[model samples]
Structures are given as C-alpha cells and as structure tokens.
Target: MEFRVLGAVEATADGAPVDLGSRKQRLVLAVLLLDAGRPVSRDRLVDLLWPADPPASARGTVQALVSRIRAVFRAAGGPELVTEGPGY
Candidate 1:
C-alpha cells in the first residue's frame, strides 16, 4: 500500500491506483495520513472539512467519508483504517 500526498493525494495498491472517491474523501485521507499513528479529533476534522460553517451532519459526513475510504483500502487488500477514540 502506498499513499502519495506530495503531488496529489493518491493511494495505490500493488501499483494500481486506488479510487479515493470524492475530493473531500481524499482530503480526509490526506489529513489522516499527515497525522498517521495519531488520533485526529472529530472537531479538528470538522474544522478542516468545513472551515466556515459546519452543518449539524458534519460529524456524520466525516464518518461516512472515513467509511468509504476504509472500504476502498479494505477492498484493495491494503492497510486497515483504525478507529481510535472519537476519530478514525
């Protein structure tokens, strides 16, 4: 499994590109990768995902994005997305 954030946020498995879904999902993965091995708080993610006004469903949106990302990794037989405390 390889994650690239230098040029563009990208994930590849076995040399094949891994689809990361939407732009927001990719951003979530990038943020998490930047803080790898550390638990990123939900509030922090909310702020990053929506800097101006975060809707009431912002938390759920993050979770859904994480879930989608995890599914992609899981299907690709890559790394596991670990959930720690209030974050993923």
Candidate 2:
C-alpha cells in the first residue's frame, strides 16, 4: 500500500484508490503517518484532535477510529500498518 499526504490524505493499493472514510479518520491517519515509526499515545491523539476541549469519550473514539483504519488497511493488503502497544 502507498500513502499520499502532500495535499490530500490518500492511500492507494495496486494503483487503485482506497476510501479512507471520514475527515476525522483521515486526520488520525495523517498524524500516524507523520509520526512514522513512533508510537502516538491516546492522550496525544486526543489533544491533537480536540486541543481545547476533549469529550469524555475521546479516548474510546480514538480507538474506534484507529480500528476502522486498521480494517481499511487490512482489506487493502497492507502489511500490519498500525500496531498497538503502549499506543498506535
């Protein structure tokens, strides 16, 4: 799988475009990509996403979004793109 983030956040497989879902999902993916091989904590994601005001369920929301992204990558034949440890 190939990812493009220069302008639009995009992912492609075998020259075919992959649907990355909502704007929030794209944003999450962008952050992870920008971080590359580093782990991004849930707190960091919540901060990056909400900044001023994060909801009580921000962490759960982040997990859901990340799970969806993982499904997308899995369908695209991506090689274990996002892994969970201390973070994603």
Candidate 3:
C-alpha cells in the first residue's frame, strides 16, 4: 500500500483506494505522518483530535483512532508506523 500525505491524507492498496475510516482517524494519521519516524504522545493526539471539550470517553476514542490508523497502515502493507514510548 502507498500513503500520500504531502497533500491531503490518502492511502491505496494494490493501486485501489483504501479507506482510513473516519475523519478523526484520518486526522490522527495525518498528525502522526507529519512527525513520521517519531513517537507522537497520546496527550498531543488527544489535543489534536479534541481541541475543545473532550468527552469522558476521550481516551477510548483516541485508542480507537490509533487502532484504526494502524489497521489502515497494515492493510496498505506497511510496517507498524506509530510506536508509543516514554512521554509518547
């Protein structure tokens, strides 16, 4: 699969378009791609995905977003791109 993020975020698998899921999922991937090869903190992801009032389920929402993004990358035949570590 190939990912295009220099412009709008897009993913393709075997030359066919691959859906990355929802808008929030795409945003999560977009932010991570902007800082590719690095660890993006969960807090930062929360901030980017929910700038204003965050729901009580915000953490779960972020987790789901990350999982979906990871699935998209895997479906595109790419390596696990987002790695979580210290402060990330």
**Which candidate number would show the highest lDDT if scored against the true structure?**
1
Candidate 3 segments exceeding 4 Å error: 86-88
* Comparison by TM-score, 1 against 2, better one: 1
Better of 2 and 3 by lDDT: 2
Candidate 1, residues 17-37, lDDT tens digits: the string is 989899999999999999998
| lDDT of each residue in 26-47, candidate 3, tens digit only | 8888887778778888888888
Please count the clashing residue pairs in each candidate, in the order shown. 0, 0, 0
Q: Which candidate tops TM-score?
A: 1
Per-residue lDDT of candidate 2, residues 53-72 (tens digit): 99999999999999999899
By summed lDDT, the worst window of 10 consecutive residues in model 3 runs over 79-88
lDDT on C-alpha atoms for all candidate structures: 0.91, 0.90, 0.77
Rank the candidate models, highest TM-score first.
1, 2, 3
- Name the lDDT value of residue 13 in candidate 1: 89
